[model samples]
Target: MGDFLDKRAEHLSTGMKQKTNIARAVVHQPDVVVLDEPTTGLDIMTKQNIIEFIRDLKADNTPVVFSTHHLDEVALLCDSVCLIDRGTSRFCGSIEAFKEVGQSGELNDAFMNIVKQGTMHV
Candidate 1:
């Protein structure tokens, strides 16, 4: 723990900060983990790493709730997603179900389709 801090505590990038936050959250071995915008400001490779890490955690039966504006990230990392727009739950379902909402095969497109349906304030 101290070694991790010594290595990453100084001059951390946004992605590194997010990773540190995740490490801190999981260090105690909690039953549930909730992350908000976990991949914001990360490069593609870094995002992939974070997604894989979360997947591993889930495989270990750790319940994780991640919030992000990146619908593609949600598609890749979430088993189920609840899309909130203007503080309202506009859509909630499995990623496959959400994908069926759009023809473009993109989660962001599906999300936009649902949002355009007038259920959400945004």
Candidate 2:
């Protein structure tokens, strides 16, 4: 994007537009940052870059709130999670605690169990 700094967003590709939006969001260094599906359609390297960027934010003590359907992303990036089912929050807690409740000690299994029970614990 070094050469794209002068370009208008309307002329940008979808991926570039996504990056631009993210840049806009954090330019002011807000207390909390919220992103929805930040890496859904990005290329592999871009996705990894975004993950590392989030990690940098975490290191800087920035509280990031991102919504992603990718469980693998959650496992990699989240310290705590809020599991929502049918527009309702079923669980919210630390990742370790969440995994401990599962039979196999796997996050996906615990998530499934929570979804199955529809248990409400916010």
TM-score of 2: 0.88
Span of 10 residues, lowest total lDDT, candidate 2: 97-106
For candidate 1, write residues 1-122 as lDDT tens digits.
45456674567767677778877788898889988788887889988888898999889989999888876677667888787878788767777776775434788787788878756321
Off by over 4 Å in 2: 2-11
- Relative to the unseen true structure, what is the C-alpha lDDT of residue 21 in candidate 1, on a scale of 0 to 100? 82
Q: Please give the range of 10 consecutive residues that has the lowest summed lDDT in model 1.
A: 1-10
Candidate 2, residues 13-75, lDDT tens digits: the string is 888988988888899999999988888778899999999999999999999999988888999
Clashing pairs in 2: none
Best by lDDT: 2
Each candidate structure's TM-score, on Cα atoms with residue i matched to residue i, is 0.78, 0.88
